[model samples]
Target: MKNIQVKWWLLLLLIISTTVSSCEKEDSGNAGRLTETDFMVAAANSDLFEIQTGQIASGKGTLSEVREFAQHLVMDHTTSSNELRILANQKKITLPDSLTEDNRAIRMRLSGQSGVAFDKDFIEVQITAHDEAISLYEQATREIQDPDIRNFATKTLPILQGHRDHAVMVKSKIDSF
Candidate 1:
């Protein structure tokens, strides 16, 4: 009788442990899914970086082409940022109001440059930033579950691609000089 009781207790404990383990796995799976909030936060950060750097480039760039490209970045990213803000407000997700620490550092570094050096560095920065933005938007389009956010990502990818191509062109021009 005692042996049977011990066996039954062990079985109950084993079942409980297995059930608990399964529950943990399910919870983790849900946590791993890409959400709109995550995409928005990252998008907001990217827009902020673009806008700030563009502002600097517009003022400090030696070349008219570089200044024009900077102006374009500021205009487009400002519009994108405003739209993101509206979406974030609707979803009750507070988007970041400023650049990330790394971006702030980049801004500081760019601020210290002037003339042709500034234009070259600014174009390089834009190329790298737009590349990152394109990747983020592409990933969001593929992995995000929210229809609105996925649509936004899909729509924005082309713009990011355009910016990257323009940046590459600007880099070539700067290199030729």
Candidate 2:
């Protein structure tokens, strides 16, 4: 009788342990992963910042090249933002809708400038923003476990590189003037 009681207790413990383990796994699902979620949020914020700053540059920049580049940024980032939003929705990720404090400060600073100064500042901001975005996307491509998010990062990287190259070229031209 005692042997049977001991066996039943062990079985009960085994069942309890299994149930707890399964619950823990379920609670920590894919959506809880920081790498994927962080990448989406950061990407969303980046797109918003680019679109707003590009709009400002398009109107305030004195140089045609700067205005044209700004227009491209506005268009491209707007498209990217929409795509990201769809992806985030599909993945059940909540993305930020507005700029971060740092981005807000940059936008404020850019908004206060005009003419040549505005052109130079805008180009400089573009270069820096593209560099950071490229880094984030590249990291996401490497570290993200979600196949869809990784694919998004992979697809967007080349476009970001192109933007960075264009920004550099524009900066050189601005410096020469």
Top-lDDT candidate index: 2
* Backbone clashes counted, model 1: 0
lDDT of each: 0.91, 0.92
Error of 1 at 100 (Å): 1.6
Q: Model 2, which residues run further than 4 Å from truth?
A: 1-34
* Model 1 stretches with alpha carbons more than 4 Å out: 30-32
For candidate 2, give the lDDT: 0.92
Looking at candidate 2, what is the lDDT of residue 142?
A: 73
* Top TM-score model: 1
Cα TM-score per model: 0.91, 0.81
- Pairs in clash, predicted candidate 2: none
What CA root-mean-square deviation does each model show from the true structure? 1.7, 4.7
lDDT (tens digit, per residue) of candidate 2 on 1-177: 999999999999999999999998888785444488899999999999999999998889898999999999999999999999999999999999889999999999999988889899899899999999999998888779899999999999999999999999999999998
